[model samples]
Target: MATPVSGLCSLKNKVALVTGASSGIGADVARLFASYGCRLALTGRNMEALQQVTDKCVERGLDKDEILMIQADFEVESDVRKTAEQTIQKFNQIDVLINNAGVYLNDSVENVILENFDRVFVVNVRAPLLLTHLLAPYLIKTKGTVVNVSSIVGRVSMRGLLTYSMSKSAMDHMTRCIADGLCFD
Candidate 1:
């Protein structure tokens, strides 16, 4: 049986980079991809947590040389760029890029501070944009794909999440704009 997204049974020759891979959806996606034989570059702020995920991948039969774990805080543009550089250095090219690092707060506008707003935008919006920009040429070279995890909050506004919603809205628009601007043959 073949994988759902691609017809091939394995991604043996492909390389992928997954951000926020310490846990949750990112971790799951990385595991799934690894099972398909995709070499991975996984990133998260917590080194220990990222190592755990990598360990799981190793247990699943991925070779030690096939996984690269990068400790990064996506809020920092420098870190995001360095991640892209390191991944390229490790894999030579990235066949897929997953921007999955994100944060959420239950607090409403009244309780949300300016710092909170900045952190949300920096991680959820700016960081992804910068990373995408840095790695676009390589993606184009490989005819690769970028999957960004966006929230429904961007389209539906609810109380207490004003800033988060705004950031997601911006992220959605940015995604579309990048897709339109980049022409893939």
Candidate 2:
């Protein structure tokens, strides 16, 4: 017989890797996942905020050892790679990958520059792609899911957030392609 669902959001014992988890939606999700008994590898640019979130998870009944917090600058290739490596090293399995890390460049298309544009895309678009690539094998083994957090700006033209919007659009497309590519019988 099929098992009955528990609580409102139960992800018990599942290993989840959440990016941009220091403060914001990522942090909230991590807390929720923890409350539901998920093992987590959470990455963000701020160590302090990450620790605070970790503490909150503990307060929600998770053991301190159940969470791994990594300080990462998503725009840096080495940091992105390290985030994936460390997560796999800790959990040895990843059931959920939440791609919520993003960088916002407040520049219109007219004012956008190559340097700023590169930074935004590297953090908002490329890092998640690299993480998914590194984690795909584990995800496939578990038949897991990937959640890419994006903005409405991706679907609409935002005058001052041209680069950010474009980057999220790229992220949305990348998610779709990965989802399609990872489909298995």
Candidate 3:
């Protein structure tokens, strides 16, 4: 029998690891997921901002123990690995991984420096790929979902954002490749 959409979408007891949860879309996603009864492992570079989001989630009905806030800079490989390890250690399993951390460097093609371009790619594209690789085994074990947030600029390029746009475009391509590979498995 086909399950009802409500039953299918219910996040009760699911463990979600949301990156960039300190602000904006990531913060909002963490709040909504918590409201749906999912245990959360929130990560970002800003400890204060992440704590505020965690407080908001607690107010939304999740228990204090149901949330784990890890302050991590995605650009750092050790931080990325530690974040994943801590989440797995806390929850034992991860049912959802939201890769929403990204960097935006506003520079035209001529003005963009190699360092700035590398930073954008490292945070926006490489970090997500690394996280996905690290968490793929858990995700496959539980048939969990991985959501990689990309920008509209990836589809339609914008002026003065060459590096940012390029990074997001790589992210979009990586998403497509992962989706295709998943279908075969």
Candidate 4:
């Protein structure tokens, strides 16, 4: 069943930025947002998959220009900054920022190398932090929302995912801090 008008009203005509939108949860959110008449800026490492998602959004009634696809690798700092700038450049305003780009490394502390741990943290935690910082001004101007996608592992211990769990825990904390800060701002 569809959500009632009151529930859906706020999303219509809003501009949303969704990372990791080439597939999975990010793509699904982008599609739903587009269906609600939201303009979207999508980013991911896979251009082909991102294009497919954009096509689906277009089919859902969004014009080609209403959707912007940026291919960005979260591990690269320059790419992360560029993604935010490009989104703002295209849309002029951002009403929603979904920090959903992440990496999962399945290895215990005993086997995980420093390189793997660093890569996971960079993608899962640092990138989101940087993106949020870069877009804070625009988001504040519009009183926009920021949705940080976290994992259950952050709350509960999981085997073979030490780095992943830690990164998610950091994200959860970051969300709380940002929310509190926003309340004051």
Winner by lDDT: 4
> How many clashing pairs does model 3 include?
0
Query: lDDT per prediction?
Result: 0.88, 0.88, 0.90, 0.92
List candidate 3 segments past 4 Å from native. Answer: 1-9, 183-185
lDDT agreement of model 3 with the native: 0.90
lDDT of 4 by residue, 48-122 (tens): 999999999999879999999999999999999999999989989998999999999898968988999999999
Tell me how candidate 1 scores on lDDT.
0.88
TM-score of every model? 0.92, 0.94, 0.94, 0.95
Worst 10-residue lDDT window for candidate 1 reads 1-10
Q: Which runs in model 1 stand beyond 4 Å of their true positions?
A: 1-10
Angstrom error at residue 46, model 3:
1.0
TM accuracy, model 1? 0.92
In candidate 4 the C-alpha lDDT for residue 165 amounts to 94
TM-score of 3: 0.94
Clashes of each: 1, 0, 0, 0
Candidate 1 per-residue C-alpha lDDT over 62-112 given as tens digits, one digit per residue, 9 for 90 to 100: 898999999999888889989999999999999889999998866685687
Candidate 4 colliding pairs: none
Off by over 4 Å in 2: 1-10
